[model samples]
Target: MIQTGQSIPEVVVQQITPKGIEKTDTVSLFGTGKTVLFAVPGAFTPTCSEQHLPGFVQHFDEFRRQGYDVACMAVNDPFVMQAWMKSAGVPDGMRMVADGNAELARALGLELDASAYGMGIRSKRFAMLIQDGAVKQLFVEAPGEFRVSTAEHMLEAIAG
Candidate 1:
């Protein structure tokens, strides 16, 4: 996995917006300041829907107040990301990124092959604190494990 202090590779990821999905990249998203990026294996999956995403939405303000642009990413199409965002009630303060081709995830070395579990290549569940495009902290969950990447954990980490 890409380690702390490394600049995120340049890759195009999509962001779902009211107008439509738009292509965005790490430089545009995190180049100017701090960003809190969290990734899920898939959108609308149980854990992702019930916990992972909600945690970020719930803590979006705290993250912003702490000077972070929080975004949720998944290896899903922009349409799916849009629907999931609506269903998840993603706040305006938060953003959803579509790693449709897993490009960004692969660049971060956080891509996962879940063929045995019936899913194809996906982004591993993970989170990172990036400052001006460089990783400051990275928390990647072991397969099927959810820790370290939780919003509470990040909040606690940032608080201290």
Candidate 2:
């Protein structure tokens, strides 16, 4: 797993934009400023659609007010991510990352072997605070648990 003080790996990723799918790199995405990057196993999964993503959407302003850029990453493709963003009514403050091949997850050492679940390789539920290319804090949830990585928890953690 990526430890605090370590720089985020430079891996190319994709995101769905108004124009089309845009290719971007992790360094440019999370390296330049304070970023709250949250990951889910897959897009449209129950917990992810109901709680995980919504929590971030609800507290997005709080994060932004504190000058943190919020982003969501999933192992799904850009098309799925874009659909989820629209369906969830995600605000403009949040950026969606499509880790289709789990490249970023593997780089962070946060990949989950979910083949048994028929999901193939996916990202574990986690959140990280990255500042100026280095990780400041990391909250990785235990398997089948939702606690530390929630937006509310992250807000409290950051405040402290």
Candidate 3:
């Protein structure tokens, strides 16, 4: 997996925005400043919709106030990702990445084989603290667990 101090991989991904779906690369999306990019196994899944993504939504302002751009990525289509964020009431400017082909996950070596569950290839649940395109800190959750990658945990991580 990509480690701390490693730069974010250069891969083109799609982002959902008010204007329309836009193509963006990791460097352009996360290269400018501090960013907290959290990945979900899939959009609208139980834990993701109920807890993981909500934690970040609830603390969106806090992350921004601390000089960090917040982004959520999922191995779902741009349309579904946009719908999920809308259903979750995400604020404007919060980025929603659509890793439709699992390109980013595979590149980061964080792909999860969930074929048994019929979910196909998906991203492992994790969060990364990035600065100027390099990973500064990373929190990856164990399979079926939801502790380390939450927004509350990330807040504490940056605070200290």
TM-score of each: 0.97, 0.98, 0.99
Worst 10 residues of 1 by lDDT: 17-26
lDDT accuracy of residue 131 in candidate 2: 93
TM-score: which candidate is best?
3
Error of 2 at 26 (Å): 0.7
Predicted candidate 1, C-alpha RMSD: 0.9
- Judged by lDDT, which candidate is best? 3
lDDT of 1 by residue, 1-160 (tens): 8999999898988988777789888788878788889999999899999999999989898899998889899999999999999998988858789999899989899999988889899999999888888999999999779998999988987777
- Point out where model 3 deviates above 4 Å: none
Candidate 1 lands at a TM-score of 0.97
Q: What is the lDDT of candidate 3?
A: 0.96
What's the best-to-worst order under lDDT? 3, 2, 1
lDDT of 2 at 27: 84
lDDT of 2 by residue, 35-125 (tens): 9999999999999999999999999999999999999999999999999999998998589999999999999999999999999999999
User: Candidate 1: where are CA atoms >4 Å away?
Assistant: none
| Model 3 weakest lDDT span, ten residues long | 18-27
Cα displacement (Å) at residue 33, model 1: 0.7
